[model samples]
Target: MFLGYHILTKFFKNGELSNDSPKESYLYYEKNAIDGDLQGIIQKLDYLKELGIDLIYLGPIFKSKTTHGYDITNYFSISENISSNSEEEAKAIFAKLIENAHKRGIKVIIDLVLNHASKEFDFDSVPKNLSVKTESPRSPQEERWQMSFLFWNLDDEDTREFLIRVGEYWLKNFELDGFRLDHALGLPLNFLEEFSIRMKKIKKDVTILGEVWEDEGDKLKNFNLLKKFKGNDAQRFTSMFDFATYDTIKEVLGKKNGSLLELYNQIVLSNQLNEKEFQLTYFIENHDLPRFIDICQDIETFYITLGLLMALTGNVMLEYGNEIALKGDQTIHNFHESGRVAMKFKEDWSEQEKKTFNYCKNLVDLRKVHSSLSSGSYELINSEENLLIFKKKTTYDEIKVLIYTGEQAYQLDKEYFDLISNNKVLKLKRGIYYLQ
Candidate 1:
């Protein structure tokens, strides 16, 4: 029952500029060096602890052209401009981070973008003259193999083999606790199954979470599409990002259909994944979407939304820059890097933002204290126009009943204490009860 953040630069760096290219270049430089300034990150360790993040998932610190380095250029190297990019220096910083995080009882997971390398990476440095050959429908054999990527020619066995080796190299070298794989659906199924098997041998308890944005059940039915990871295929990678829930929310919101209650049904129904699928990475937004605050509009509702995710069943997650209410524009153009704005901690947070932040902290606290939310079975007890009743029950003693209020506030039994507010018992039978 831990909350997670994708990027932690805020804890280490200072004065992140918001302007375009200069900021991007500055980010590149800061990331390449290890000494940029990590006090900001250090100071926030306790803050994350307060929020109950037993783990934090750093997106990518490897060297790359963009500020948010998803496109990994050097798998073995840290970004040079970042103060600790030198091998020794980077290891030292990583050691300290691991030690500090462990002391706080937090686990660290690094994002592995094994699906593709940045087109900007100096491919010439590699042993082979491997590069994208042509961008057309038909090209020479060598040319096509060089350029084949996630969306295109990776169908080649040699290219897939190279990618698989890259994954294995990281597992053996870095000793990473776990990996949050990027665009897992695009990967060759056989490769994923094999990679997961080899990586697990290195660390028995290592957790692997796949970012499979495809429709699990439907897609898998079409010739096993390397989609669903089940049975022997079950890599240590146990969970998946719940894009299904996010999509449903968008649909519900657009049609202005069913209350928040209906939304909850959609979530629980979607989550009825195969038993092998152990966890669900739940979130309203991430590096790819508009900020949760911007989407919800009402800050209070945002807090309630977070409470639902945290308090409901399964493993939940919060993005790296999500805690401070970081907002970014979502567009098809330059959409990749532009989605992740520098995290603002000192000033941009609104009062409502603080309230939502506190709510997240409290909800995380409740989840850990109440294990039923984590390991228990979830049931959708009731569903109406705007209100849905869901219950989480564990083996022994805990039972959490969730009431999701959509656009309108509904009434619930006054006996239940509002978890957000300390255990102050309420007496009113029904009065605008949204999320409690």
Candidate 2:
């Protein structure tokens, strides 16, 4: 069952508040963008609602030194860059933003970097030996050094209590729906279990999404690691970002002579391994990865790849401006600065961009209307050299998705309604086709 399903149903009558929308998608916003402030984001709630977005994963709003907001100095205070006023005023603005978003039926999940903090964080109570010096290799010539930033000594009772308090304070005070835990794999399993337990206690319907960018087989590896942290126990995290799926999609869609069979195998394997109740957050591009448009080289391939992502069984997440073909590449020197550029709106868009946006909006709408596309069992109908066909079926509905990456158009045997065009399509072309 989806987390917060019952509570959301009880609160909202129209079934819009539930997180189980097949179109449940996320948009990652950077704080430094042109219209990235809390007020600016509130002003654009209608844009997101119109795009069929169900959730907004705002990048860290806490006090931080870097533009990315990962190196947080104060977890309790909102960043001065995101809010130029007093801390209390900033909190008020954020609360108002949340109020507006909830009113529009869009959930908000803020980023929480629990693995590490900035060197400037006050750590006087913790022992000096707990501090660790770390360096991130930027390039062949340079490295960024981080000194005395503690990853929170999990063994210490005081540290765990403080962190739990932080989690509870935000959930209770801000009325937040959930949190996106950054670098979650780096944190100890014990800390995760306890943190999740405590946070859920405060708000039972609150969701927790962890950043676990390892192979699908690493769930067993994580299980083993948790055993080492303590004895055998159940995994507590609700879901994690599916990096394995992202990598397979990139390999097939981004490269020439990429195999459709390999991509099909990865999709099947991921479904087999993932837990039924725990959904994997799926995305083609994020702040850490290069844009799909930059790697795919052609718009047709990009749209086909996006269609495949939307058809997968999980919570779909799209980085900001991906629908309009925002292009950027992350480098060791610039880090993710290039990938985290400002978002473009209607007046700043081109003809091609508008087309891509409409295509994405159509896909999102199709997902929302069909139950099979959102939460259903998957079955592979056919897998040819350059063409792939699959079906997602629920008891009530079934959706068939076809993808042809070859040069020539492909023909179909039966007539079906094209979800993209909302017209009866008799044959398949050298593009993506969806039938319900």
lDDT per model vs. reference: 0.57, 0.68
Superposed by TM-score, candidate 2 places the C-alpha of residue 147 at a distance from the truth, in angstroms, of 5.9
What is the per-residue lDDT of model 2 for residues 1-436, given as tens digits with 9 covering 90 to 100? 2211101101111211221212222122333334245666776778888988878887788876555566667878886556544788889878987899899888888888776677677455334444423334322221232442445555666666676677888998997988888767666677888988898888777778777653333334543332343222225666666676677787788765458877877777666544654666677777766668877889988999878877777688888777788766444245345565666778889999999999988888877877777677888889888888888899998988888887876777788887877788876667888786
TM-score, one value per model: 0.78, 0.82
For residue 5, model 2's alpha carbon misses the true position, in angstroms, by 20
Candidate 2 wrongly placed segments (more than 4 Å)? 1-35, 124-150, 214-234, 273-276, 329-335
lDDT of 2 at 293: 86
Each candidate: RMSD: 5.8, 8.5
The pairs that clash in candidate 2 are none
lDDT of 1 by residue, 235-346 (tens): 5366666676766564454334446665766565645652544666677676656666666555455555666666656667787556555555554244333345555553
lDDT of 2 at 407: 81
